[model samples]
Target chain A: MSLDLFLNQVVPVRQKLFRFAYRLLGNEEDAQDITQDALMKVWSQQEKMPELQNMEAWCMRITRNLALDKIKSRKYRLADELDRAGEVPAAQHNPHAMAEKNDVMGKVRQMIHELPEKYRTLIQLRDMDGYSYQEIADILELDMNDVKVNLHRARKAVREKLQNIQVYGL
Target chain B: MDYNQIIAILDRYWEGETSLEEEALLRRFFSEPHPDMPEPLQEAVPLFGYFQEEIANEAALPDMPEIPVVATSSARVVRLSPFRHWMKYAAVLLMAIGMGYAMKQYQQREVKASLAEIQQQKLEAETRMAYLETKKALELLAKNLNKGTTQMQKLSYFNDATGIITGTN
Candidate 1:
């Protein structure tokens, strides 16, 4: 497709991509850099883009690779260091909030963070990105059935973890 | 609590047997405020709720940067071809060296021509100096010859004077 049409249609999805990266990396700066780098790469390779079957998925795949590389390189640890140094503001804890609102949500996020990278990624693609199983499979390079199976297990694990947290209060 | 129905679908879910519609049904059932839900299922609601929140919030994510569309009319995978990369550097180096060698040869030829012209000029100057010296010597000789002729005329006048004096005697 032409660059204009690609940008017009695909550029609007940058925020969603950023959100996905932020959710995965749990750091805004890293997410922003990854998004920028991924977009730049996509921009650079605009000449060899695949057919427009799923531009967003293609972009997500690129973002995922970049984020994974960043994670592998441990470059994100710099952001983590900054976060620890109080340079970065902590997420709101809201100590006086309702149990359902704060504790449950907090536990859910913790459970998601605790999930294996593969499961977290699958869940992110499916739940957060709203990709279909086939699309998730395409992005993750897994079988269609494998995508469904992993997603189910990932959700189930999160559910179990949350249930334990609520019941045991630990 | 109808745990059996929920359990049945949950089993299907784990096996990847549930369709999107069935999954949506599970999400709907779990998200609703049902007082009859089992303790385990009730505890699971918030997790499902979080998933729902994440999905709904997906639309609310910050704006993503625009990705430029590459025209894929000739959609070939672009790898940096090793040969092409090498050839590009090779061509640049070749051009640089070729220009350098050409410049060196040109300077050498220029220096040689300058030396040859300077030698020719020196030879011409020497020839001109020799010719001038020869001409100066000839002029000097001519001046000496003219003085000799005047001396001979004086001598003849002296003889005429002596002859006149003697005849007058």
Candidate 2:
């Protein structure tokens, strides 16, 4: 395919790619930086990329690699400081109608953040980005069965955490 | 309440048995407001809601910076000729072998030159030692001949004196 056509197709998926990076890295600046870096890589190899079957998945794979590199380089602590800081105010408020939604959302984010990096990454791609199992497997370089298994386990873990929260009144 | 069916599906899900359609069905089922649902499945409602919300949020991510365009050439798509690839590899291999052979030849020449130099020095030292020994032997022979000549002259003087005394008597 021509360069213009490739860019036209890939540029629109940039946002979703950035979002995946953001979730993986947990920082907006790093996400943006990784997204740009991935785009540059794809641009450099545009000649070899058009032959690829799933361009979006390929681009996302690049983005995921870049984000993981950033995480490994800077050693981001997985304490979910962003979620915790945002949660403090909601935690202080009572279970008011509007606050309850925020609390639930906060708890969900915390649960996701608490998941292992492997499971969290697959979950972000499969559930958040809406990628198919095959696409997730390709992007993550895992077996299709592994993707399905991890996605299931990740969702189940979240479900279990929510159940425990309700039972223990957290 | 059909909580047993939901539980069974959840168990199957963790085992990686659920299809994409089945997963979507679970997501939808959990999303509904079922007041009569079991306590565990009830708690799962908020979690599923969070998943959907997060997905929507990801889809709504802001635009990223535009990537710079690169020039594309159609000629690049043509597969490299097999013969050309083979030639390239052969050239690389030949160059590597040639370099190794050149290095070996250089080392051998260095060793040969050094050996020749050592042999030449040993020959020159042997010639100088032979010349010094010959000069010492010639000096010893000359000293011995001078001593013999002196002894013969003294004996002739003695003989002449004895003959004169016998004639007078």
Candidate 3:
């Protein structure tokens, strides 16, 4: 019975968990390990499975905790944003316009990375992953209002930076 | 959507009030190029572009390998090798050999120590016997010397008496 539940619910969310882990750990390999570990942990704690209302959020929470613990234990350094900055896909046909777009995208990536970890995560979960505020709150273990306020502040910060980049090209 | 509608949604988005559908609309709107894009909407282009790129990248990621699950009661039990704990067995064997060798060395030392003690006792006994025999031989010589001294004294006295009688004649 438990196996059926796991296969039906938990296994399907593995990709989401992996992506969340990857964003947190900033690497694919560690993210994959954390996802696997989180799955094993969820399996071991099968007794709590029936009680959980949001199994996907619970799995993501487990993945985040595991990833954070790994970061703390190893003092893991996130992958350099500058290194990945060059990976932006070309969006323009002209060489000059493509380079310019790439540069702007790189700046945007850097701007996101420069946000505080909480703000950065909030932005990514809301904007990139399209997680609802309640799901994000469950995953991060925060209140709904707290998620809203922090997300607003995160967006405000990004917007101000974006304004700065526009006005001063800084 | 009209430019005014997008600007309104974008403004709501900046206020952190936009719903998921509105945000998706904004993302879709930014994914394409607008030759005459409004000034207010241009700031969001790169941000949404980055998000779209990231989503694409995640979608492009290789699927995770299938995790083995024992979903059925008839799942086969994996047989583990006996040598899986070889180090543990090897450590026990090493400890046993060390203890055995140590015991053998201790027994040999004990035997050697006892033999030395016995040899020392035998030497002590032989020296005591030699000392007693030498003392007995010296006592016998002293007794014979005493008897000869007593006979010489008696002979001297008889000679003195004969000298006195001859003076009287």
Candidate 4:
């Protein structure tokens, strides 16, 4: 029964878990390792399955913790911006337009990345991953109100930066 | 969609009051090009555009490696012989023998020490006995010598009397 539940429910979310870890660690290999470790952890703690209401959030929480621990243990720096400069596939036809678009997107990425880890994680989890505030709260082990307030602050900070960029073209 | 509605949603989004649906709607709205984009919407375009691109890129990530199945019920339990850890048993036995030898040696030393103490105590008692006997013998000799002195004193008295009688004066 436990194995079946694991294969059905927990195994299917490895991609999401990997993406979440990747966003946190900013490295594919580390993200993959963290994902596998999270799965193994979930599998090992199968006795808690019956009591859990949201297994996916628990799995994500585990992945986030592992990734954060890795970041903390090694004082890990995210991959260099130049390393990911070509990551976003360009859709523009003109060379100049593509370069400009890439440049703008890179700035946006950098802006988000410059936010504190908590704020960056909140933005990515809510805006990019489309997780509900409650799900995010569960994953982050925070109160729902705290999640909303922090997310509001994070978005506000980003908007201020965005306004600056729009006005100064910086 | 009306520009006003987009602006309202964007405001709510900035305040973090927008639901997931509204956020998704905003993402969809920004994904398309607006020929005459409003001033307010321009600031959010890049941000939403980045989110859309990030989502796309994440979606394009390859599937994770296959997970191995963990068997729960069919776990095999192998029976073990009693001497699986013979070295540990040997170690324990050796330790016990060593402790026993040490205790025996300690007890033997204690017995020998007590015997020597007893012998020493006996010698001390015998010496004390000899000293007391010698003391008693010397006391008797002293008493006899004192009696002889008194008799000699009496004889000297008698001799003086004889000398007086013999002088006749």
Name the best candidate (by DockQ): 4
lDDT of 1 by residue, B1-169 (tens): 4677887876676555676666677787877778677764566577677787766654555565444445567668978867768878899999999999999999999999999999999999999999999999999999999999999999999999999999999
TM-score of 1: 0.59
Q: Is candidate 2 or candidate 4 better by lDDT?
A: 4
Sorted by lDDT, highest first, which candidate order results?
A: 4, 3, 2, 1
Cα lDDT of model 4 by residue, A1-170, tens digit:
67777878898989999999999988889999999899989989999987888989999999999999999999998987877866756566788988887778888888999999889999999988889998999999999999999999999999999888878867
True contacts kept of each: 0.67, 0.70, 0.67, 0.98
Question: Model 3: residues >4 Å from true position, as ranges?
Answer: A85-92, B74-169
> How well is each residue in B1-169 modelled by candidate 2, as lDDT tens digits?
3778887776676566766676777787876778688764666677678787776665565667666666665565667677877978899999999999999999999999999999999999999999999999999999998999899888878777778888788
**Clash numbers, per candidate:** 8, 0, 0, 0
Task: Encode model 1's per-residue lDDT on A110-137: one tens digit a residue.
Answer: 6776789889888766644456888887
How would you encode candidate 4's per-residue C-alpha lDDT over B21-136 as one tens digit per residue? 99889988999999899898998988988998888888887889987665556669999888998999999999999999999999999999999999999999999999999999
- Would you list the C-alpha lDDT of every candidate in the order shown? 0.74, 0.76, 0.89, 0.90
lDDT of 3 by residue, A1-170 (tens): 67878999999999988998988888888899999999999999999999889999999899999999999999998888665765655465788978887778778878988899889999989998889999999999999999999988999999999988888876
Top lDDT hit:
4
A-chain TM-score per prediction? 0.80, 0.84, 0.93, 0.94
Docking class of 1: acceptable
TM-score of chain B of each: 0.42, 0.39, 0.44, 0.48
Any idea what lDDT model 4 has?
0.90
- Candidate 2, residues A1-170, lDDT tens digits: the string is 55565667789888887888888876677789888898888888888775888888889889988888877888875436555464343344456765777777777777777889888887666555557888888888889888877787877787678777787856
Candidate 2, residue B13: Cα displacement in angstroms equals: 3.3
